[model samples]
Target: MATAKTEKLSASLEDYLEAIYNLSVDGSVARSKNIAQALEVSRASVTGALRILAEKQLVNYKPYGYITLTKQGCIEAQRVVRKHNIIEKFFVDVLGVEHTVAQKAACEAEHAFGPQIVEKLLCFIEFVNSYNKNGYDLHDEFRSFFRKHGSIAAGDSN
Candidate 1:
């Protein structure tokens, strides 16, 4: 689990931080409207969120200007973003969920699921991928088998 200070982050704040970090990766700064568009929030909401992040020492925000993450904020955002990606991979590879749905669901789950669980999920993903070259999907015929044998169906993992 992350420390209590990290838990202080709301999902929205994390999302904004991630957006800026990603944009700033290839550029010098991030515009607020771009962050808003990426997160599907309005410009006003982006401003308000930036205000909160500035108070938390996560960002440097200037009205009608640009935003940039502090060094500590960049590290934190990278960790959070990694957790989100890990969860997305878990949903897609382990649960056989679709990519787009997994992205959204992972966004919601990353905050609640601790890094230890995410690490376990990463290992599970690698274990599943070990059989990839053999051309298999874990979920093929999954529904029928589950219906016939109950949820704990045979061959559920493979």
Candidate 2:
């Protein structure tokens, strides 16, 4: 719902938004110093990012005041969080990737894929889950096949 302006956010801004969302999940105030620590960026960098986000109406920022996400900002941040979760699950559950590796990979991928691809992936994951839940064995078959032969290729002689 808040994605119209969110679509214009750079990846770095998206990261900042996500970090703010995560930090604020406990309903505590998110200070600039905390945001900087969470993002491993300098306070000056956080200040700059907060200013840009404020201009976009994504954050409420007053110099020396606590920073908070505007409703739109919260929505956009949650979207990023959801994408990261989905990608991590897809990697670990479907591809048999290790959890730590999947987490790192998901962070990179969440920003790379567009909505259509993400929607398709979500559908595919749900289908696979339903299939497995109904006593089908596609999960094991796919995992075994991938382990044996990596990614499938076109016109492969099998």
Query: Best-fitting candidate, measured by TM-score?
Result: 2
Residues 1-158, model 1: lDDT tens digits: 43224446877788888888888888667888788888898989989998888877788777776688887789889988899988898887666666887888888888898778888988877876664546765555444564676665436332
Task: TM-score each candidate.
Answer: 0.75, 0.82
Question: Candidate 2, which segments miss by more than 4 Å at Cα?
Answer: 1-7, 150-158
Q: Which lDDT value does model 2 have at 99?
A: 89
Candidate with best lDDT? 2
Error of 2 at 31 (Å): 2.4
Off by over 4 Å in 1: 1-7, 131-158
**Compared with the true structure, what per-residue lDDT tens digits does model 2 show for residues 61-113?**
88888789998999899999999888888988887777888887888788998
